[model samples]
Target chain A: MKVELTLFGQLADIAGRTKFQLQDIPDTDTLQKKIHEMYPEMANMSYSIAVNKKTIHENTVFEGDANVALLPPFSGG
Target chain B: MSERKIKNIFSQGPIPATFIAESIQKHSSQTAIGGHSIFLGQVRADETEQGKVKAIDYTAFEEMALEKMHQIREEIFAKYPITCMHVHHSLGQVQAGEICLFVFSSSAHRKAAIDSCNEIVERIKAELPIWGKEIMENDSHQWKVNK
Candidate 1:
């Protein structure tokens, strides 16, 4: 399945762009591994994955097309 | 508890003092509200190794923040006997010493208003999916993490 990934906060800085598309990433676990492989610096950074705007703690499988977000620790007032 | 719609709490740039005043003025018609509590978050010029922060650039995952905020709002209303509540948080850049966040809670008595207002602020700081990039004088930057 194809999915779009949007990075937020410091992750956006590391990626040099905010959004990208990935193919064959069926689950959040594989997505994390692929992301770290692409941006090794992010391996040590702590962040949460949000699928379709909902933050998920456990690995979630994507049925079809999905919108994924890499959210760093929130700092809003 | 009454039925309430999910409201957008974001405003571009700093929240002006006049706007805040107008909000309070509008609420005067609601005589049932005996007390109102307000919380204003200011951008402090924090010192870092790069330089002193001159401003903050705020951004958020809007869809998620609104959804999460709606849940928090509903929970607060159920827990407290508040008459009304208003929240406004700044987007984009806000200079140091300017107001970036405003939360107002009103109730029949002071205790409910004050307590709910304080609790909302804490939850907002910890729960919302927003970020602030500290802009330094020399064009350097750092991300702000709430304590």
Candidate 2:
């Protein structure tokens, strides 16, 4: 399945783009696993996942059309 | 009818005093106890382990931020006899010592207003998906957050 992935903040800067597509991932967990595999640097940073703008924990299923975003810890007032 | 107001969220501009004044005016209750308290958070230039923070560039996951803000408003209203509450946060780049957030709450008595304001601010800091980049004097930057 194909999923749309978005990177924000420092991740966006390091990745050099805000949005990208990941192919061949079967589900959300696998997608996350693939991301960590592709970007080993991400393993050291804390982040959160939002599937179609709603935050979810591990084991959540990802429909192919969902818009997934990777977010770093927020620092706003 | 009472008015409900939502103001613009920005990152590099002044927080309007009207948001606070209007919240007070809207929440006025003749029979309820009367007092209001506000908490304003301002950004300051400071030295960090990485470097000197010259300014902050603020950004938000807007869809999620608004959703969280609405939930917070509802929770505060349900938890306290608050006449009204308002929260405003900035979006772009805020210079050092500039206002970034303004929270206002009004209730029958001073205690509820003060307590509600504090709770709301804490909730916002803890829950919202907003990010800030601390720009250094050397043209480098790092993300800023409360530890």
Candidate 3:
């Protein structure tokens, strides 16, 4: 299934774009691996995956289209 | 008391001092509130290996931040006997020495207001998804990580 991938902060800088479409991404684990494969630099950074606004801690299988965001470390005051 | 709804806690740029003063002035009629505590976070011009930091350009996953802030607000209110609280954060570039965050809490007593204000600031620092890119004097930038 195609998923909407959003990158924030330094992750966006690394990705060079804020949003993209990941076609045929199967599950959260695969999605992570696919992203790392696509952007090896991302493998060195720490980030969280929020699917449809809720952070995912465990491996979750994606069934349909979802809004996925790769959020880097927060620095807000 | 009326039900408090989730508010948009972001401002486009640096929060003005006048706005903060006006907020305090508007609360004068709230006779029940005997104490108020506020926390303002300012951008610091820290020296880096490259050069001195000039400003911080902040960005966020705003939808998630707002939702998390709402939850934090409810949690703080439940934990303290405060009258009300307000949290505002800057979105774009905030120069060094400018206000980037404004947290205000009021209560019938000083202790509750002070404690709640502190808690909110800590929580926002630890939990919010806002990110800052520190721009240096030479115009180079680095991503900031909260300690």
True contacts kept of each: 0.98, 0.71, 0.96
Q: If both were scored by DockQ, which would come out higher, candidate 2 or candidate 3? A: 3
Q: Model 3, A1-77: lDDT tens per residue?
A: 98999999988998899999988888899999999999999999899899999998999888799889998878999
Q: How accurate is candidate 3 locally (lDDT)?
A: 0.93
TM-score of chain B of each: 0.97, 0.82, 0.97
Per TM-score, the best of the predicted structures is: 1
Model 1 chain B: worst 10 consecutive residues (lDDT sum): B1-10
Best by lDDT: 1
User: Can you list the residue pairs that collide in candidate 1?
Assistant: none
Evaluate candidate 2 and give its CAPRI docking class based on DockQ: medium
Q: How well is candidate 1 docked (DockQ)?
A: 0.95
Per-residue lDDT of B29-57 in model 3, one digit per residue for the tens?
Answer: 99999999999999999998878999999
Candidate 2 interface RMSD, angstroms, 1 decimal:
0.8
Model 1 in CAPRI terms: which quality? high
Candidate closer to the true structure by lDDT (higher is better), 1 or 3: 1
Model 2: how far is B26 from its true place, Å?
A: 6.9
Candidate 1 stretches with Cα past 4 Å from truth are none
Q: For every candidate, how close is chain A to the native chain A in TM-score?
A: 0.98, 0.88, 0.95
TM-score of chain B of 2: 0.82
Candidate 2 pairs with clashing backbones: B10-B90, B10-B91, B11-B91, B11-B92, B33-B108, B34-B108, B43-B97
